[model samples]
Target: MVRKQTELPEAVTIAIASLRDGEKSKVGDAHDLLQDAVLGRQGCLRTDKPQPVDWAEAAWDEFITLMAHDNNHARSIAGQVLSNLAQSVPPETALRDLDKVSAATRDQMFVTARHVLQSMWKFGLGTKEVRRALVAEFADLFRISGTEKNPTLRRFDIVTGLRALFDETGDDSLLQTARDLISLEDDPTYRKKYSGVWRDLIDR
Candidate 1:
């Protein structure tokens, strides 16, 4: 589905170039290119290899500034890229930018928000403090997003993110918090739908 070039370094280069264009209101191309680089095909990134970490880390400073771009599109892409680079850069960088990435979870574009939240696990990789913070952040967001119109799906997405983190870290606290959040849903049908998300995790 991603028509863009699949090479990691090349993709990061194109994404950064598009980000520059984004500053000038030329985000259409940049947004699309970055999305392909981040999302890849069938929800899997094309450049899922270890090499992308170096390329992504090289562009770290650019991403930090881009996360603050006036364009939400740029913020969305930057959040995803920074998350991807978390494994390569100092864990502190990701920890420091956690707020910026978390803010993207509330982006007006639900899809953009979902992307940021989904990739957040990268921020916590190999770090317990960051992992605990991430779980708490999602829990807080899960509690807050309840005010939104379609809170059920929002909560479900939060659980999905938690599952990813839990899978990586094997932290029971994440699982407990995920279950706690799921219990908050009022609509029985929707609650049941969402509970199915935890079935495997709880069973495990």
Candidate 2:
């Protein structure tokens, strides 16, 4: 006999619905619930270990769709959750959807963009190809951020994200690329600020 498929956890289901709700009041609570749910299963955010979740398969497409939702809050939540879900999904799936995730880094709302940018390093926890794709995406972001408002801060985030990825993967090439990107900074003050991100890593 064919058995019935199990349902997603009630909290996850409600959180998704509330996030999609037009009422702004519901979003904050929903975001908190969804984040907690994903993190409870994800364990420490710094680790590269994959703790696959049953709900990830069902929620993956929904989160991807919400990345382009009308509300910027929805977009931000979607982007952040997608990054958290990266390790839960197949490595190839994460690599395939990298561009979609990267697009959120340019969201019209600067806060939304920053949220996405800061979370992107989580994608590097996947396979080597995923890490390679993440590095390429970071390189492109660093190149284009020069014209954006608060370019230095954006570049700082990119460099710091590379550091986080390097920390998780122990990949020397990632660390070298981050230092190389820092060297490209023309302003001494901003370059110094960027370099400081690596001081601890360098010392170790």
Candidate 3:
């Protein structure tokens, strides 16, 4: 659910503090609060809103720093917040940090990597330059992911992101790329499972 504009300041304050705490040291109430603010509990803010952009703008530097934090959880949370607040991030800042975001997709921790992959698409929503970079980056990732251990899971995520991009921009090429990804899967069972990620578009 969307949050009241008045409540955004407090939430952003807490989230940035929690994010900082996660960076400073691991086990603490800040870590827990950061997780909740970013991932959210059932029916809560869920960290999905763009309204936090104002607050996020203030914490932009901190978030960028946290993106490379030694802790994987901090990196993941930082990446997601940056993506969610992409619209608020200056275009130059987003462009400069795109590499860091790209690197997170290959993070050693699968969960952190997956979170980064899932949210990276939002960076494009901020500007045309970012959209171009994000699309190119994701396409390159799709081309390379087949050699990974969990190619199917990664492809599924890629296609899902492509589908969202298609929906936003009405880009048929994005859908076609997703189809190409599905066709590249050698394992029929995994192929089918991954195709299910685009079932609606495929069937249509």
lDDT of 1 by residue, 83-112 (tens): 766656655665777888788777787776
- Candidate order, lDDT descending: 2, 3, 1
Task: List all candidate RMSDs to the true structure.
Answer: 5.8, 4.2, 4.6
For model 3, what is the alpha-carbon lDDT of residue 180?
A: 74
- Which candidate, 1 or 2, would have the higher TM-score against the true structure? 2
Angstrom error at residue 68, model 1: 3.4
Backbone clash pairs for candidate 2 read none
* Model 2 misplaced stretches (Cα beyond 4 Å): 1-7, 41-51
Q: Over 4 Å off in model 3, which ranges?
A: 1-10, 23-52
Instruction: Give per-residue CA lDDT, model 3, range 53-110, as digits (tens).
Output: 3444566677788887777877887777677666666777778888887888888899
lDDT of 3 at 46: 18
Note the residue pairs that clash in candidate 1: none
Better of 1 and 3 by lDDT: 3
TM-score of model 2 vs. true structure: 0.88
